[model samples]
Target: MHSLSKLFLTFVGFVGLSLASPGGGEDLPAVCDFAALRARWPKESCEALTSIQAGLPDLLRRVRPYTQTYVLVLLDRPDGVPRAWDDPVLSRLRVGLLADTPAETIAARYKFAQVVPYPLSPAGACALFADLHRGKIDAGLVWAPLAGYFVAVTDVENRLQALPVPQPLPPLEWPKSAWEGASASDSDLFRCADRIQGVLESYGVAPAELLTANVEESSVIPDQPPPEDLAAARVGEALYYRYCDRCHGTQAVLGRRGLELRQRFLQLSYPEFIRAIWEGRPGRGMPAYRGLLDKTQIEALYQYLRALTLGKIAPRQSTD
Candidate 1:
């Protein structure tokens, strides 16, 4: 009877194990299946998912997804950037954070001499690094992809570094919903928000909140110029602000390394201007705008630059 009881206990344990297994008719939906998640969560939680998925390839491609945390640091010497986490002098330096960064969250993670708030957008990571390079700020926290792009373009990898923020590994938490049995979390949605936040933070010249501002759309250029030229220049100015102005500056004068177009306007003819922008100076960190900006937009940018260079239009002050 004792042996019979032992055998029955073993059988029950085996049945329990089988029922808990994935093949036991209790498998969870794949994490990538948004449709399954949508059915599980409310509609609004999934709204950000589409944009998140759309941008993931570009954002994730730039950094190791396995890296949990990062810190931006300035190299003491050109060769002083530390390769390992335990390297010395890391805690002694002053650090820069995005103006909108939840300082409380970061302060709890690491000790620094001080945390300086930089007014740039997160897309302005390069600009932030430029600040570091110029000694405007000591060190800054930046995303891996932005750091990678900065190093690639400026060839300044040795001059700066991003150290992994040393912390007890925290379990990756995803955005949770109130629905019953909705085990999946909205990690993608948070990542999407992070991407947008990064862009806003790096754009230091303007208020990060202005990204969502509901300003009435009007012609970028006044209605005084020839209608054709006015239309083209206006579109180009918008393109320039969106793509070019961060590094170039409001008047194209404050560019980190970009030529002050106002000063060099006479030296570059329209064709030369177009060629420079279209082809880009690759080794100098200028990306070719050919595929990104179409011929018409490029022309409009050229016209806008020309207008700015020739003193035909006053540079618009950043209201932020």
Candidate 2:
């Protein structure tokens, strides 16, 4: 290992004395996992999950699923929580990390032993869990939630075990627009997990839990609702917070200026917006919400977007 990388891991371990591991149940956007990992169903039903289309270029179709395998590695540490990497428990073992994220996410701070250069959807994660349990690989790294979800769905014997990655997770994303005209090599854009879909069919299954969602609507932003749009906007605001906030962001501030809901609502007529929702822009990692949210609910979402675009509600930006 590089001398500086060794020094840094030692430093981060000191910080770990106070830091808590990330929550396994927190909601994540589609890029992390949707029907396959984390997804928020509406008050009534969850729309069926969309499959990666066979016709689209293989890279684009697998983009979202591949996104999760990148960033950090979660290893099985039975003795105690693994802190960065200097612990005697990991001294000789070649630790694993994924490359689905930007190099700087991990490379800037600490060094990892090996980065498996491939991507997987939820199904691939299942195969990996099987591999780990069967001892095909030792000292492996995996997306934390993927491990959690796999255990939840499978792992009947309770044989699988893991220690959460203790550091803060980097902001992992692969919004399709970000790749709109990409010229990067195949390896640069993604390849976060082992390539192993042929052995399992979990790729075709859904991993989302269908719960009876409970909600009454309200804006996460400043909402001085106009009298006529009041009730509808209230419901829409609730929906936005429940489903859209994770990606669109707090108070509707999306990743970039042009992609913000406030901006998109300005140019899109009601029909265009709804159509976009009905037939999601898959290239961008958004899943079609048609079955999950009904017309009435969608119409309410539009009311909220309308209020947002016209400045009826105040906008909020992400602080983290």
Candidate 3:
């Protein structure tokens, strides 16, 4: 149980601290498990949990005296928290700091130990929790909400019930996008727990609750809406990257191709723009993204491209 707790903490840290790329599509910060560990163990018996939020490998030394054999699945940000690695100019960028924990650290912990870092997407995360519920792994750490979703759907027997781990540190709030608009209420949090509990119930595994929940207290960036200027630019950038970056480099598309197509495209009414997207020009191989994007997204893209035409959204000069 101690070993599992330590592993869970390490897993959460890796997910929270990754540095993302700037030009990537909309990305979410991965929600990390931050439930308390001590509540499960008799208060007097358990050692204090090492800080997972520290975002360092050396910190694992506190747990080195424990067992061995760890498979670390590096998590993508799901909570949409602002990462230190995020760029001020462009959003949605992340990269892992420590690819895998030091081999020496693993060796020191157990006579026989192995550490492998498997990067998993959100889809992969769901699949993982499914396996965990089935007793595929000795122990697993995953998003609580997802753990809940899996349990509810699988209807696994209660070999393992979801346990609520209290966080040693103060509670934190992940960004709004974390739950895809799900209100962050006690009910929502418990719903996540219920999902996991359901799965554990089905599997007949007595769910062990951790003592800590390592949630963020506040976002690195405030919750205020983007400035109008910045919002306009973001919309423009998103559209340019998604639709316009194919034929020309972003800068070239914005600075040159945009100029070339200005009058031609402006003459296009909204319906024409929609048509261009829905029905591709066969010769050009410009396929339709009608279903891929919503009306707001499409309009944002339009505003961005239009800004380019007016010379209001030129690409930054290349440092290279």
Best by lDDT: 1
lDDT, candidate 3, 154-209, per-residue tens: 32222222222211211122232222211233433333333333332222122122
lDDT scores in order: 0.45, 0.40, 0.34
- Full ranking by lDDT: 1, 2, 3
lDDT for model 1 = 0.45
Name the best candidate (by TM-score). Answer: 1
Native-to-model Cα distance after best TM-score fit, residue 287 in candidate 1, in Å: 1.8
TM-score of each candidate structure, all chains considered together = 0.36, 0.34, 0.26
Pairs clashing within candidate 2: 118-192, 118-193
* Candidate 2 lDDT, 177-210, residue by residue in tens: 2222212244422331122111011111111121
Candidate 1 residue lDDT tens string, 44-72: 42344323322322333323332233345
